[model samples]
Target: MNSDGANDMNLAALLRAGADDELQPDQKAHLDAHLRDHPRDTDRIEFERQLKEACGRVMGPISAPPALRERLIASLDRIAQDNSPRQEASSTAPAPESVRLAQGVESLSEQTRRQSFWNRMTPAVRALAAAILLLVGGLFLLQVVNVGSGNLSLAQAHMSEIATFVGDEHDRCVIDPSRAAKFNISELDAAPALLEEIVGKSISPANLAFGGLAFRDGGRCHVPGKGDSVHLRFDVVDQPGETVSLFIQRVADESDELFESGKSYELQSDNQGRAVFGWAADGLNYFLVAKDEALCESYSIERGLTPNAG
Candidate 1:
């Protein structure tokens, strides 16, 4: 490749890395210098940003069915309450096949004539068929419970990480000039048509200056191991010392169970005196973190995190 082609390729690679937040400190500094000299390179930045946003919405949230969730919760409660080994259900039960046919299922004679073949068949075949069906049913139920438990465990694990990130970004916003409200919401919302078509809502910058809060500064950070996210800082109305900030990122698969897609949750505490909570919409995760719990709740509600927001 020619010199310009090589530079373009290098910049393109940097943009993708920056988009995914996979940039190392030195590489990030390198990208900043390149963008500083090559203003047109800002286009790459925008493209990468939108691409991350679009990807966040790539697959809709997957969650356990309500029935499965309930079963898992019950199982978890049981485990929590009693650490001692309990008798397995099977160990306490009588001959299952006999019990099933004698009580749970109709006897061969009681069954319709079409099923009388069950009686004509060898007892071993009948027992094997019943056992297979029971085994399959048991496996299926265990799978459903496992799926539910696994998802919830994952979502819970992300909570601490979220609290940590929100706190760090809040501190960063306190000093970053870019966190100030400079860009209009329309300009912020100017994303590709494909994104709008897929997501339905404008992926534009929202004017979050409300509820005694004014937009201050904002920036984007690509989280290592996680994904890209948007960060915004806000002044606490007139309370200079107090502050509010938020980040919106692509949700992780494990975190998808945090809510039904589009539902909001109220998060609390990083032990750093910050209150946090969030919701997902159109494939993106939205979180608001602030020192003031009331302020966080206010922003959440204004952003449509209704009365029942989790």
Candidate 2:
């Protein structure tokens, strides 16, 4: 090919690699130099980012079904057997013994010997093997799916599902304080800084503390498929028994219709009678939950989370 044509192909390849985040540091430097000469290529970088985000939204995350999980386990077992040293040696040996054994273990002694391998395994060894298999399965499953924040879109989510998580977290931390240690509870004074560090934004107490409730404790909690989030527990100054929880999660897209600015959505009450309300602001999703719906609504209004509050 001509020299100009070759340079064109190289530039195209570099642009694609850079866009996909596969470029080495040296190659990225080259791309930077090229962008200086041809600023138009910068548009390609933006286009690729948008394309990747769009694809993630469309594909979502994939989880293995029970059937698929079983199949994966079986496949892994077969692979392990195929790669085993015993199988390798047997493959090179005379075919007659292997074929005969496959057809039938000719004697009771042969069957007993085959069973001896398992019989010799200690409980600890067997447990270790089982753990290895489970770890392998989990790693394989992760590779087959995208597990990003974009996987859960608040606009399409059922309020019941989100509210259920909020309610459960509240019960665990506020109602049943004995179990709060599981969440790695933080001191009241350090909770705001912890929330800011985790959520990547400064969330002052003024934003979450309201309605005569004072911060009692805060901690991290997992929201199942969504991810880990910070939950701040608040107790009424006068009525110590009355408590509320505010959950803060960093969202992939704060522009979701469900998160329209200054508006709160009331969620379905969980079986435990917790009232849940949620809103999104500044790239963070907030959930306010309490035993009394009136208390939750009052807090939402106080925080300017309700549409009419403004």
Candidate 3:
């Protein structure tokens, strides 16, 4: 392209990179010069600055309604599974409607993965993605903060909410490893040690047993109005397709009747026969998801993970 065309291209790149903090020194310098030379472009820069500021506020973060976030994360997994090149049994993707939604989310996920890619997109794309997720569970996020400001209680609604959180978290880590890496627990420490510190509770991976699932990885899960909650991933020994994920987080308390009566653990299974158990332990809430029902049942039976608290 000609010099003017090249400069325009650079300007476009600078605009995109500026929003994503990917602007190189030279590119930023060039952008600054160009903006100074052209007052109209300055307005565009201001708009981008504002947009970036907004995205910073509402990302993956606080008090997002469990139901809404889970719905969105499930969309990511189901679409990816459908589109997976490995799924040659059927060449068709999900309905166009679902595909479109998934594409939008995956596209955002991909762009956000790399600073350079995010820096190359137009402001319109960035604004659309940031707004979409930011709006989900926003009201619920506010509510979480509000409740947390007061005493923490496991109200009926909160009980159901935590249940769904565990279920979705299980899928998030297993269904799509790449997506789950967004909140990966990469700290350099043993799983139990990290959990003790991060969640402010004490528990051992050996104690949890996980029904013969070997501990593979562990990390924190973020919820609105909550800090870092540990999510530990495990794989069933010698079982290629079976996986287990456990989430442990500090809670207000479990002395209430909801988690007692020897029926504290709830076993939920899907049509595919996958089952997950959620319960409160002393003070920490735990969700253990089993990917293979047969193996999980055998292990759960062995581990005393009956309908009652273990």
Candidate 4:
């Protein structure tokens, strides 16, 4: 290859490594120098950044079910085993220094012979293999989840989006109590009516306040990408720092529908640390997010929305 062609290849490899967050400090310096010379490549980097952000928005918030998670873990292990070297090398054959540098592998000849199988695979081959694995794993996950079965359906994705949004708000307020408006127990009487005016559902705070939970504070909050929602926080009576959040939002809006109407769903958690138990009542969707899974179940049962154990 000509010098320009070789430089193009090197730049491409560096860009890919940077996108994957696998670039070493020296490789990053190299990428920085190349980009300074070729400003036009900035568009490619921007495209990669946008694509990664979009994927995270869509997939990162959703937590896989335990069964599907285990299956994927097992599949990954099997792939690693399959890719493992089958025999000891008779001689120390060194990979090209450029390849070693790009891969962030040691340049020493002995280290080259002991390089990880994944590090040895070309980027093209690794990408193709990853795509194939994702395709198969996605299909397997779909089968395991049994979509459209009325139980835990595809709607969970939408639910997860909402849960993640609320969970983040919950975390922010808890970490910095000053960010949260203090809840007056006296206002509990009018809070339901206020929520009803906005969300069209009136819930009795007495019913939700249980397990040493006392009303802390609440106010209007917005789900980042979706729309408006109402937030209510409760302090675990004896536990100083522990809190729970109750969220009320329209079941469906012009843009997105959170839960299927007339269907009962169970408690679940997004990728966030909190567990979320949600139900649709009247025209509003109610979500209870707490750190304790037992609290989620308790809240669901309190609402008499827990599905049968069958």
Model 4 misplaced stretches (Cα beyond 4 Å): 1-155, 181-186, 224-227, 252-256, 260-272, 305-310
Comparing 1 and 2 on lDDT, the stronger one: 2
Instruction: Write one digit per residue (lDDT tens) for candidate 4, span 93-116.
Output: 654643323222111112212323
lDDT of 2 at 69: 72
**Candidates' lDDT values, in order?**
0.49, 0.56, 0.51, 0.54
In angstroms, the error of model 2 at 15 is 48
Runs with alpha carbons beyond 4 Å of true place in candidate 2: 1-158, 175-178, 182-188, 224-228, 254-257, 269-272, 305-310
Off by over 4 Å in 1: 1-152, 175-207, 224-226, 252-257, 270-272, 305-310
RMSD of 1: 24.2
Q: How accurate is candidate 1 locally (lDDT)?
A: 0.49
Per-residue lDDT tens digits for candidate 3, residues 106-142, read 3322321223323443676446434432544222110
Best by lDDT: 2
TM-score between candidate 1 and the true structure:
0.40
Provide the lDDT at 192 for model 2: 60
Of the two candidates 1 and 3, the one with more favorable TM-score, higher being better, is 3
TM-score of each predicted structure versus truth: 0.40, 0.44, 0.44, 0.45
